[model samples]
Structures are given as structure tokens and as C-alpha cells.
Target: MIKVVAAVIRRGQKILICRRPEGKNLAGYWEFAGGKVEEGESKRQALVRECREELGITLSVGAEIFRAVHDYPQYSVDISFFDCTICEGQPVAKEHSRIEWVGADELKDYQFCPADGDLIEILSRGQSGI
Candidate 1:
């Protein structure tokens, strides 16, 4: 399985989400801002690195809030969702097609990747304040 890390970066009552751009796998699906865990890197390292690369911000990664394993036709992922904070710089759409700050209740309105189903449900239900 491919190891992935995701950040649930919260600001007041809003959480950051990114839309995958066209030409990428699972394009148009909303997801937490993160990417794959590179070899020799810890999960937190990957989270911080991905946020910088994809959002152009420095991230202070927090505790793991959720985890899930999902298999798509082409691949499988073991994703760790972490509660994160922005430590420096504003978020820029460096890699995503669009970025949005949405309340937990609004999570259901957008389509998400199949792997994110459980993570979205937990967040939308206000289970962890993620």
C-alpha cells in the first residue's frame, strides 16, 4: 500500500480543503491538503513538506485525528489524517485547481475521493473538531 498523509488544517470554524486539478488522478475530488509520504520521511515530515509544496505554507502538524485504508482500481492507500495549523505564509493554490475553507457541515456538499469517505463523515459529524 502507498502511504499518504493528509492535514485537517482548521481556522476558527473553517477547514482547508483542496480540489484535485484536471489531468491528475481523481481530478475534481475535494481532499485535505497533503500528499504521499516519501521514503525515509516520517508522517509529520511528509505532512509539512506536502503543505509547503502544494499550498505554499509552512505547517505545524498535530496529532493524528483519523486513519483509513482504501483500495481503488489502480492502487491502494493508507492515509493518516492529522490536525494541523499554519505556522507561516498564506495558502496558495500551487498544486490544486482550487482551495476552499469550509465548515464541517459543508463537507457533504462537495464530492470527495473514495478514500476520504470515512474521514469526511467523521469531520462532517463533528466527532473530532477536525
Candidate 2:
């Protein structure tokens, strides 16, 4: 299984989400900015690195909000989702096609990857119940 890490990066009342670039795996689907976790690195470390590389920002990893094992026909992913805060730099689409900051209520409007859809639902539920 491929180990991946994603940040549920938040600022004020908005959460950051990115659209996958065309011609990439799961292209055009909206999801959090992240990448595969490399060998010997903790999930948090991978997430921080990925945010810097993919979004041109630094993140301070926070709580682990969700984890899911997703199976595709070609491969599988063990995805770890974390709550994060921007430590520095403005977000830029270094790897994604685009980026947007959406409010919790607006999350349902976007088309996200299956695993990410699950994550959004979990986050939305948590926010609503609080």
C-alpha cells in the first residue's frame, strides 16, 4: 500500500483544498495538497514536506483528524489526514492545478476524491456538532 499524508490546513473560517492537475493520477479531482510519504519519515514529517513542496508554504502539523485505507484497481493508499496551521509563506499551486479556501458549509459543493470526500464529511460533522 502507498502511504500518503494530507493536511486539513485551516485559516480563520476556511480550509485549503486543491485541484489535481490534468494528466496526473486522479486528475481534476479536488483534494488536499499532499504526496506520498517517503521511507523513514513520520507521517507528520511527510505532510510538512509535502506542503512546502506542493504549496510553497510551511505547515505546523496538528491533530490527526482521520485515517482511511482506500483501494483502487491499480493500487491502494493508506491515507492519514491531519489538522494543520500555516507556519509561513503564502500558498501557491506549485504542484496542483489550482487552490481554494472554502468554508466548512461549502465543502459539499466540490467534487473530491473518494477518500477526501470521506474526510470532508468527518470534518463537517465535527464542526456542526461543536
Candidate 3:
């Protein structure tokens, strides 16, 4: 299974979502900002590293908001989404095709990865839980 961490960088009514770069799995699909959790590191550590590497920002990881296990033909994924606050630097699309601050109501406008289906539903319903 691939262990992954994602960030829900909530700012008022909007949350940060990123598009996978072309040529990558799930390319062109929208998803949260995070990456695979590396071996020997806690999920939080990996998330911090990912935010810096992918978004060029420092993060103050907050409470975990969601978790799901999804199966793909090639592999299985365990993804956790956490509420996060940016400590420094603005988000840049260093590794993604683009980045957007989308309102929960508009989340459905973008195609997201299957692993994010449940969380997307939750956000669409109302993000009070997160």
C-alpha cells in the first residue's frame, strides 16, 4: 500500500487544491496538496516535507481531517488529509499543473482522484467536520 498525506489549506471559504502534472498518474485531476509518506518518517513529517517540496511553503500541520483507503488496479493507497496553515511562503505550482483556492461548493467542478471521492463529498456537504 502507498501511504500518502494531503493538506487542506483552508482559508475562509476556500481550500487549496492542486492538479497533477501531465504524464503522472491521475494527471489533470484535482487533489489536495501533499505527497507520498516516506519510510522512517511520521505522516506529519512527510506532510511538512511535501508541502515544502511541492508548494514551496512552510506548514504548521493541524488536526487530521479525513482518511481513506482506496484501491487502484496497479496499487492501493492510504491517504490522510489534514487541516494546515501556511507558516511562510505562498503556494506555487512547482510540481503541479496548477493550483487553485476553491470553495467547497465548487469542488465538484474539478475532476479529483478516486482516493479523494469521500472527502470531496464531505466538503461539498459542509466542511464543519474538517
- Local distance difference test values of all predictions, in order: 0.94, 0.88, 0.93
**Candidates in descending lDDT order:** 1, 3, 2
- How high is the lDDT of residue 46 in model 1? 95
Q: Tell me the RMSD of model 1 versus the true structure.
A: 0.9
Instruction: Mark the 10 consecutive residues where model 2 has the least summed lDDT.
Output: 121-130
Model 1 residue runs over 4 Å out of place are 128-130
Report RMSD (Å) for each prediction in the order shown. 0.9, 1.5, 0.8
For every model shown, what is its TM-score relative to the native structure?
A: 0.97, 0.94, 0.97
Give the alpha carbon lDDT tens digit for every residue of 2-109 in model 1: 999999998889999999999999999999999999999999999999999999999988899889999999899999999999999999999999999999999999
Give residue 90's error in model 1 in angstroms: 0.4
What's each prediction's clash count? 0, 0, 0
Q: Pairs clashing in candidate 1?
A: none
